[model samples]
Target: MPETNLPASKTSFVKGFDKWNIAVASGFYNQKIDYMIEEKKQELDEKNRKYIYKMLTFSLLIAFILFAISLYVSTYLEKYFLKYRKKIYKEVEKNKKKDILLAHQSKMVAMGEMMENIAHQWRQPLSIITTCASGMQLNKQLGLLT
Candidate 1:
């Protein structure tokens, strides 16, 4: 028989004993060893199944916790972003109003400069007309315009 198929013996061998004599005296059987091996394999399989179930349950619980945390963080960030965006919008509106006010002031300044330029342009012509009218009045008084 091959070494792997040899039966396990409960009895220990005596020193200097003949191997064939011990085999007969020990009364060990192959069928009993095979039965014990099969029972041990089933016991180990059961233990492995219980360990796998525990690991699966623990993994699912951790996954659920992580999912909840992600949801909370995403919601918090969304609200914060909205608040920041509103603040920025208000700032932009305020700057737009300031720009409009500055544009109006600039237009008023330009209009005042235009009115000054128009008055300067008319001054010389009005002075010339006044001098000619005064000379005509003086000539009429002297009777030089028959």
Candidate 2:
């Protein structure tokens, strides 16, 4: 056996140390990436919730406004209808009064015509009776009524 002197090298140990350091850095990077992803998810969820709330509020406001408009319109129409009905009642009453007046005037005209006819029928008989009474009186005075 020949004895030869050689320098001690730490290449293997240095290589193993480098490998360990690389593994640790990789693990830290993976952890940081996971944390950033979780933050982004939470932010997206908050934005979605705000948008839904705003939409709901807007929809409710529109519905309330429509209901108020309908109520006002219905009340206005009812008031107008009542006024028209009152006017119609007044007109009907006026017509009825006019009809009664016309009936009374017609009855008066008919009565006047009937009275004139009765007077015309009695005139001739009354004149005949008067002539007979005067003749009798004259004969009695001359003594020829025996």
Best by lDDT: 1
Candidate whose TM-score is highest: 1
Model 2 stretches astray by more than 4 angstroms = 1-52, 124-146
How does each model score on TM-score?
Answer: 0.66, 0.49
* lDDT score, candidate 1, position 109: 97
Candidate 1 residues 1-146, lDDT tens each? 24567545553343444765543233345666788999999999999999999999999999999999999999999999999999999999999999999999999999999998999889778888888888888989998777
lDDT for 26 in candidate 2 is: 22
Please give, for residues 1-146, the per-residue lDDT of candidate 2 as tens digits: 11234333221222235655542222224444566999999999899899899899999999999999999999999999999999999999999999999899889888888888777778677777877888888888988899
Clashes within 3 Å, all models in order: 0, 0
123, model 1: CA deviation in Å?
2.8
